[model samples]
Target: MDKEEVLNEKYDEKLDRQDVEGQLELNEEDDSPIEEVRVTVPNTDDPLMPCNTFRMWFLGLLFTAIISFVNQFFYLRQTQISIGYSVVALISLPIGHLMARILPTRQFSLFGTSFSLNPGPFSIKEHVLIGTMTACNTGTAYAVDIVILQKLFYNDEKPFIAGLLLVLTTQITGFALAGALRKFLIRPAHMIWPSTLVTASLFRSLHHSVEREDDVGRMTRMKYFLIVTFGSFVWYWFPGFMFPTLGMIAWICWINPNNLILAQLTGTNGLGIGAIALDWSAASYYVSPLVTPWFAQVNILIGFILVTYIMVPWAYYTDLWGSKKYPILSAGLYKDDGTAYNKSLILTDGIMDPQKYIDYGPMRMDSFFALTYGVGFAGLTATVVHVVLYNGREMLDRWKSARTQNEDIHSRLMRVYPEVPNWWYLSLFILSLGLSFVTCVVWGYMPWWAVLLAMGIAIFFVLPVGVVQAVTNQQPGLNIVTEYVIGYMLPGHAITNVTFKTYGYIVNVQALTFTADLKLGHYMKIPPRIMFMAQVVSTFIAGVINLSTATWLINTRPNICTKEGYPFTCRSTKTFYSASIIWGAVAPDRVFGNKDGALYSPVQWGFLVGALLPIPFWIASKKFPHITWLKYVHWPVLLAATSNMPPALPYFYTNGLFLGFVFMFLLRRYRYSWWSRYNYLTSAAMDSGVAICGLIIFFAIQSWEGEFPYWWGNPEDQDYDHCMLANANYYGEIH
Candidate 1:
């Protein structure tokens, strides 16, 4: 792709202002006042530019399909990883320009419309739209979990059509909310969706190049990205495949391999006190070290320390929730005797039998696992309180101000393109609801009222939660709250419980995801109509691919979703299925209410604890003006830090925070020039390289047994990181 001159010459900020001003109000400020937005995002907009062209759809849909399938394929594994949209950013740019160079430009009439295969150079607008489409694959279609759960665990005979519509309705339904909330979430200069800045910065790096300058050593961003990506690709082989133990270098556990206490305190499966990840996937898994602001990462670090170091250890050592019967940390459901919970014994005809439950006894979890669930409860309420205290008035004023409030520069520039009509969003919203009702009722998933109630839950919480995410990169989830509501409402229907949670939780999540994408488009100055079209089409395609991949895996792989399946251990579904047992088949009351040995009863008070957590921070910030960090104490981000610990290793946080301190903190502060020039591009490169390499390693070699030579690095008879004692329970030693 041609670098500096072509881009600099083509996208000059001429042909603007007076042309756009005749039709729309122009903001006096040409630039975004927000520094993060201003530096990363371009101030110019070329409305006459063609973005939704043939090259975009061809490449966009292609990448979307691959990402969706790969994410869904890995989601069932023990250590699941996602291929980020940054990969799309890295790979699509060159392909896009190539298509522009090679494809025929001859115009043709199709159904009273004229179109051409090639449309100018592969514009940044097209890149932005293409990235938006691939962003749809960032999430594994949430509905696919229900499909896998039913097929693998519940043994239900649901039609493929049901799962397909489930994926479509649950995912695309959010676009309606995105359309409605653009003013509050996207247009506001204050609502700096920090992650979107990375995308904006990355696109700028990919397109614009320095012909020659001593500043960045005259190296173009494309060249820098390629170097970093290639280096990351080669480095991942040791950690990812050949020497898998490098993923978790639990050096602390190596000290006292035979001691239960030391292993429990330091193992990858335990608290991971001194463990470190040499792998990029572990470091950048939950929180992107390169992208999240220093303040947010600091808050996460505090939360992680409190939960993993202090709270969890105290609970486990003190024998809280029968902690002594299990390991300090675990990713499994258990019986009272510390054996694996026999889910099959309790389930009869896909429903929990009351007599069978009594005979089988209650399910138990490790202290860290149970407490994380409580933290989940607290995080949701904390989000409500935090948003109300921190941003209530501003959000309210924006909504009330509506179009009368002065639009930001991005908003004003976007005025050149016709906005997506309200009727379009409304049509999708109404259709998704109807389809959801049909899919649930026809397939006997959840009742019609349950669907309404779930949607109601989504509507109520979406705004407050959305506000939190819009400001901070962190988003509090709805899983805990949704499960509790439906578990108590309509218990003893396992599939229905997950179904309700999926609708209530994922509907809100999809809405937020769509809103974030809208914000990204807003920053990039892509037309709202093109943004909408790209989102809908890509989402539908990704959903189909997600469901198809899961179905194929279940149909072909023997013992899929089981521990024996090793690589395809279906670890995530176990957690999903565990929720079914706790909330659906068994009922939350018996488990979390007042039954004998109901150790988790007090955990429900997290709702109250969460509601009150933000008030102290708000008052402290107001009372003690000198203490600036008090205001930055984001309770939702804090509490939700360890939410993924069962699946996410502790080293993920430690290593991520460690690297975050280096890049986001030290480098950004100490070396401002380098940080501003190449930080985000480095992130994009690292992500792209690791993702591509991981895929190659899996398909080419890791899928087959003995493909990798066993050695000290790739151990055959012990824990990968040599935390052997950490595999057993705390006391009575269930090894």
Candidate 2:
């Protein structure tokens, strides 16, 4: 048989079922020429399931968690810091890089299952950074928001078991959320997979380096690592320690006053400061960096303009900021003081009384006034459109493939296109609703009605917002959507009641986002077993550290967890706790339409408008086909947000330009050949080394340096109780 005939026969066999016998018979034909085939062995340089005998991942995760826990402990005590999610990136980037260089080749094989981590022709620098960044991005966010926040709000009363369950639930929820989109995202060609781009860049750079040098010595690599380490170490601290007046103060004003100037100045230090300006950014920086990027996205920046310059100023001028100084009745609501929840008493002569400040700022009497419900309305509209328009076709394709394939019909179909199987989503929605009801009932903190109502509202809207966020990068899932939904539906619930809903919803969203990425990791021949155990262990490690530090500050008197003003407000356990409570319970009143609430900031509203603003131009452009600009309305909003950096614009642009000019122009021109060789490894070495330095700083130096990284505890407080003690108080004794 001819080669083409053989190829055609093989293809036909693939299409047909159980044709091995026929193919063998045909190949055995005496007249047919036997073709000698050469097969290359699959590389097994870095095996995945290395010796199913010993659990390398279990050990790694255990070690990582322990280190994280210990680091967070001192970080909380010294800096009143809680670990941020990005901190994982800070540590992992370096650790992974270093390990990649030093660790022996890992291999695994057991029973019938065998997988190897082959050393690709790529460079070590890229792989190290990719691994480290992955650990950091996924790990720390879970630590700060879920672990610390959970302990802060509920540790006093909930059992350790409950906390564990909550964490697991959050993880599971994240997995389920991402599972639906796994097919579209993980499939080789569909999504651009931006994160992988970062990883690939690092890989290519290292590959170039290896090609340039016959043998990379330990000392040479070490020298390069050290150069980058100390350089970045000093550079990072320059703005934080040397220029605290600007670094710290500007962040404070930006967040509190909703100012942009402070955010711009943050670039002076190369840190993302605009994130601290908004509550969402602050929370998001720890929960998920991908979402936090919105703080600097085109639509978000445009939203900020409308909110700060237009909406907020107008509110201030209109006395909306000063409106209803008399506290309106919370119907029959009463404070912890057992007095009528006097809106008047809370309000000060039609303005929030001068102010009894906490850590972040005064709990403004009219703080809830700035909220707006329109964003949720807009988000819901956009979400439906996105899922149906873009994802709908994909889901149909998955369904078609699943129907013809005999694979576990449910899972395979869901994996390919989860949304197509209406039953699957229906089950998830029902399950989530059921779990939420049980949570409120078991906790007995929120009324049954509140739980049911909150879930109903959340279920109705979370899909649209959550789906939009997961698939195409959109800001529809901003906490504002959940917060407002809760507020609008459950206006009568206490602040804490509302909090439960927000926490549940956000955790659910986060779990899905992270898990989706993990699916990709699994499919790409990355170790699923390792990543899974690593994540689970990392969570508990972060939890223990976060809880201990939070407890310490709560018990610390005077300087600790104060209800006082300015920095104290910033430090108060009550502020974070209260924010969670309000977000979960109040819903629309506090989150959506409340102009005074952070969720309704001019920035948020502006984004809402910008997202929808394109519709009119889109339609008009259709009518006047000659107007090329109208077709590109989205560009202006993105440009506006990009340009909103204020004082930092020159520096940020300069930094990018400097890096570009130096690397692409000067160095490349001078040593064109060497550029390909050194550039990749250089960056990998630099990032990995500095990341290690940063982790050491965080765990060894920063922990002991008298400040915690996140919001663990007040370091200045002289007499704070440890976390174990606080947990004992909350769980052991009836307060």
Candidate 3:
């Protein structure tokens, strides 16, 4: 029989059963085994059943907006950027759960075709949607540093203008880059969007529960919500004045409070031999414990070891040994007067110390050297090639499918969801770069040639970094820092430098990484618009918060922030400023210099290194396809210097063991159906708690000036031992 004939017969039988109501019991429908499984994969072409989008708006959009603004105030603590997506997910849970009970729709719209949320249990799909919206929030951390620029260079005249321009620059550039490379990035089966797994899991649980719901009771979530909120507000203010030790505990790590032995042990000179207790900075390094599964822990381990231990020690040791001078040493400089030079004053205080001004200041202009033209050309070529090769077929298929409905899964998915194509995106990217160059020129911040070079270089290099971040979760910002060295080598009269140009690379990597992660959420039935809006709202909010705090605390050198000869030290500005300098100026010199120190000066050499490192391994894998050991070895992680055994020890001891213990002792032992349902939410709850705690600690103590030891010493506020800032009530009096 034909399928239509069979459906007609079934319809007649259903009608007959309804007519004979006494014999046909409604409760019997619940006994069907198929009804128990509640699988909701929609037919590719079905139109959605109408349901109230108003409820979705409240649950997903509004909730995310409020939460994101507040969370940005705390966690990211940047007025210049925000974390709106976090709130989106939090609010989504309530919406999905509540809406599941009332006006549930099996049909939803995708390009006018119907899709299904697939009627099932109330779950966490709302969170997934929200996460997707916040994807663009990735690069704002760097872009928002324009606030600092405004204060120091522009006399804080147009903070919002700088911020807005930077934001537009980053977004336009990223979108252009992503569009150009979309085919290669999105189409590759080998490129597993790892974050997609998390989003998919959340969506599946929320919309398809044949059994019990896989989440906590509303009360448990509310309890956590209250606890985190109270903790965030309370701890944020406690260290401000009352019990100043709240900040002390976070900033200080003393071996002994008073003794000579203690001073030697706890000093920053590397002689310390104290049992290390977790400070906010060290503890904050522990974020790997939350999201990194056992399989991906190596990248986090390497970052901790390389930066926290090896690179830092090497840099510090070079400063001390003096025999083998690492060209770029500490944040401070030894000036002609023989006292440590004050960098904050030189950079931000707008004051020339007046001694040796002509001789020393000459080299400072090299900081903004032009070399981006070459890199930009290369980047443009790579982007075009990438898309043409990977996306051409897919784009054609999509076009054909749109006309005839003869589309496969990918095409159908694409059709239902229209995204701006590569050409449009690339145009925006180039245009933004041009506009930003003009802005820099107008402000007299960088000469047009120097600005173009920076723009070109940034544009060119963003491609490979984007690829790495999208493909592998690992990042290598040092790769770009090494590139700036080459920029210095180009026969230029000067350069416009930021501390670490590699930060640009890091931002690019993060942009792609976060976007791909959000896409995973997209595929799992989260609304793209919600995720996009949430991310924008959060980014803006974070930018403002970060800018205000960063400026007030980190910019006002020798007053709000003391650099040198001040009684108390403030390292926040020092650390931030030095970091920019190293990447922007120093690293480039080291990498691309004619001097002995410029060993690997050109930044592209590192990219070449990164590319070369993987070839042999990839070739081997292709040549010997059946090697199980080879399959286990992730060469990208290994080649990128992303694996460190040291940090993994504690991680393995705690989280590794914990995951194992839970998997074996609890999950396997219980074997109950309910266990599977609630596991994801259980994990999410813990994540939310930790994020809240870390954020509170970050704002209340970490950003403050002159806490444990200010970056500089004030001559007036000196007692023989500690000191104070100028405006204090006890100013010039010894504590």
Candidate 4:
């Protein structure tokens, strides 16, 4: 059947069902096994909707530039604010419609082309395209870190064009891989990227005009979204600005003020045993529980309970790696006397001096930081094994059947538009690879071969990582392991080691993100060609702006990345710089294994543990068919549960999962109609509200001095959560 016929039959069936029943629910007609996608995504398309109109380009470029500029500008700061796509989606809809109404619709001829200045009406396709562009480069590019690190720490000054090229190459290389791997990640019906579903749900809620009788008693999705968003925005002022204690209410710590162990157990910064976060930002920091599947949440919960509650407590109490001396949860590296590790002491001209390194005590970390890295290692291997065991053959079959198989409804609808040719991807991939090689070699960042190795690693791992992300909304990162391999290969080349790691790690991430966006486009029924063009343009714009912004900041602000720079003190970059010193200047073999007082050889066993952990579950799943829960044991997700530790405190998970239980579990099972219709809408609303409120607080209120008076909620001396002792971590005044 033709695309139109497929659309007609499907649309007719749904319309007829609604006409007969008067209140036909989509969840009742959930033929697709993936319930989330079925409820959230519409299996329909308007192929002739003027998606390539000037309105798309204008608004698309506007938001893409704004998002890119804002994100890159704030990236170096201690407290950074990210502007998410939901914000863009929320703001742009009215602007788009307004422009459509205002802009002249007269067709104009330029050169050989004739195009209208405005489309008939604002299209969801146009919105998706706009979002795609912004989504393509939301954060600062991986290579921007390289640029900033070089300028601030290494004092390496390359040409602006070279730095720009480096950023562009690193950022866009993944787009090529995403295009190539679309069959495995995007085409498969089962590969429902959960986050995209939320985005899809948001657009549908905003644009869809009709409402069913079943939705009469319940508020409209858009109305609910707006009310919730406004509520979130208004509510965040307390936690975000005025009453900071509202963010993490550590009531248990308030009960026993002087008790260190109790404080440690209950502190927001510590184990977070009795911590309760009222802040949505804090609540949703690590995991978006509402949109994230219950199975995934359950896996995360299991992993979190095991690692945070059981393993960490055991390791910390036993003083593993002398944990009692440093903070119980910290990402900072340290020395034998419990002072911070000063890489400056052992460095000569930005590279490691072995004799000076010997003079400084071996690199030490608290057991929690050490184990998180171990967990990261475990997560990577488990991802490989887990995907292969569970999804390997199916992926292979899906790959083979791409041409022959009967298409899914969504895929069938998408056939109305032209597909992006494979050569386009191959060509882009080759060009990006060539540029990456050129920039690295020409600018003396690394050897040309190192770039190739990095890209090769990205290609090899993209499918597994993408599959993991598709299934669980969690991607097991290649960052740690990539560093280890490159560090082994090119010892003492700090620049090369980090550059290699970024290329390998961030490229895979970019590919997965692009694939996710593509999946969103698929769900929203955007044309493949338009999606490709939108991403390409946006990536280019975002990359240039990122490099330019970083360059501008480093030049304009002296000592920008150091403490003397004050608020601009590069907190995150310091960690990035530390990683370079650890894995780049000082190779992994020296740093990780038992050597010269260095403590963390056991982290290496995570590789073995991760690889082995999945096999037993697979075996047991096969051995016992009736025991269904055993089959959902995803080691990658579980291992990665504590992946964001050190930065993501235990309370983040505590509150997030509790909310997940209420919404994703209880509401989803009991309140089926409400959950099916409004669940993803609620997630989007919450995120949007939090993001806007955060920006306003940072810029409008908190940016000015003496905005809010200090009170019990916003304490001047003690910890905000009232857990002074636990947050102190035995050391009285450590950040």
For model 4, the stretches where C-alpha displacement exceeds 4 angstroms are 1-31, 404-406, 729-735
Clash number by candidate, in order:
0, 75, 69, 0
Clashing pairs in 4: none
TM-score for predicted model 2 compared with the true structure: 0.56
What is the C-alpha lDDT profile of model 3 across 23-86, one tens digit per residue?
2343433221221111222212212312224444444445434443443333223212234333
Ten residues in a row with the worst lDDT in model 1?
A: 14-23
TM-scores for every candidate against the unseen true structure: 0.94, 0.56, 0.58, 0.95
Whole-model lDDT, candidate 2?
0.38
Candidate lDDT values, in order: 0.83, 0.38, 0.39, 0.84
Ranking by TM-score: 4, 1, 3, 2
On TM-score, the candidate that comes out on top is 4
Q: Write the per-residue lDDT of candidate 2 for residues 532-642, one digit (tens) a residue.
A: 444444554545544554445445634433345223233323433444444443333433343333333443553465356546655687689997655434422232322
Candidate 1 local lDDT, residue 504: 93
Query: Tens digit of lDDT per residue, candidate 1, span 1-735?
Result: 465336435543333333334324535376678766765776666776779798989989999998888888888886677888777887798898788767887997889999998767678889989888989668798889999888778778689999999989999887777788887888888788888887887787777643323434557777887899899999998888889898888898898788889988898877788888888888988888988888889989999999999998899889997888987778677889898888889888888887888788887888888889888899989988888888888877877885736777778778888899999999999999999999999988888999999999998889888887877787888887889999888878889999999999999999999999899888888888989999999899899999999999989888887778787898778878888888888878777887634668888889899999999879989999899888888998998898878788788899999989999999988987778778887877888789889878776766664357779888877478888777678763763
Task: Write the number of the candidate with greater TM-score, choosing between 1 and 2.
Answer: 1
Query: If the candidates were sorted by their lDDT against the true structure, best first, what order would they fall in?
Result: 4, 1, 3, 2
